[model samples]
Target: MDKKHLQTPSQTIGPFFAYGLTPTQYDYEFKSWVDNNMVADIDAPETIEISGTVFDGEGQAIDDAMVELWQDDGEHKLYGRFGTGTEENNRFIFKTIKPKSVNGQAPFINVILFMRGQLLHTYTRIYFADESSLNASDKVLNSVDAKRRNTLIAEKVGQKYSIDIHMQGQKETVFFDL
Candidate 1:
């Protein structure tokens, strides 16, 4: 017979996750047996680079955080995962192709952040700054107050796009429960 049981409390990623989560932590090339590739180049004209820093609630950089990327337009079944290095300034980068609108929604890269002091990973989306029309009509984006929508848009810099994640404080990025 089935018996009732208390669910276990969620836990943080912990300090030892590097060895198992990301290979770059040990100076080795990142290699995922399942995904095998980080760049999702379906039929885009050019590849784009996106990178950013992760900050903690205290405004300090989180050197060990990891980021997982999943675009809605997976017509090719590709994904990306990365580990932020312990550099003087903590940051993570991804090389990917531009995505197409999914289900009439604005094209965006879904991001999940796992870092210390976080019991559960946070979810966010990175929308392109140039997609004014799409961004204006996006349901997920419009759900947020217009004033705070900037948090989800990535700034274009040369060949790369930058979008920082502020875990707390007034500049906190818009995170979704899902």
Candidate 2:
């Protein structure tokens, strides 16, 4: 063990996150070069748009936060990434095909939230509302309370899905350890 190489404590997700995480999506010269894309194939099954907001413990929107989604690309492909651009730090959207099960588990989109005041990114999941039956038996979902589990489930809109992320307070989304 080298004493001079001690690890530093985690810090808040600061201003530079946009440039580092989703420069093209969040910032651009003439127009945004990146989008909140979810599917890579036009033939993907159940493609839909997902939109939501990120609220703090005090119920305030966090416009600077960056949301990222990772999931199986509705194919045999292992995983994919989407930079859910910060919609004025109030909301983010991901236009993607619904993912299938991975390793016999319930289908879900793994989410990473980077925001100010959080020393480390928060990890959560976005489960489809249509898959309520499957969500009931998910090992990860089962770990949480029956009532609180709803926090992880998205609500299906007409042609899109909605899933908000509550950072704290009573209806806080279930976060996981990485």
Please provide TM-scores, in order, for all candidate models, with all chains considered together: 0.85, 0.81
What TM-score does model 1 achieve against the real structure? 0.85
Question: Which sections of candidate 2 miss by over 4 Å?
Answer: 1-9, 30-34, 40-45, 73-89
Each model's C-alpha lDDT?
Answer: 0.80, 0.75
lDDT of 1: 0.80
Write the residue-wise lDDT of candidate 1 on 1-178 in tens digits.
5998888887898776766777654455664442213554455567888888898889988888878887757564457877676544877777787688877888898898887788988899999998889999999999998888999999997878999999888988999989
The list of candidate 1 runs beyond 4 A from truth reads 1-9, 28-37, 40-45, 86-88
Top model by lDDT, which number? 1
User: Candidate 2, residues 1-178: lDDT per residue as tens digits?
Assistant: 6568767877887856666556676554444334476555456666688888888889987777777777764563323333434465567877787777777678888888777778888899899889877887789999998889989999997879999889889999999986
lDDT, candidate 1, at 26: 47
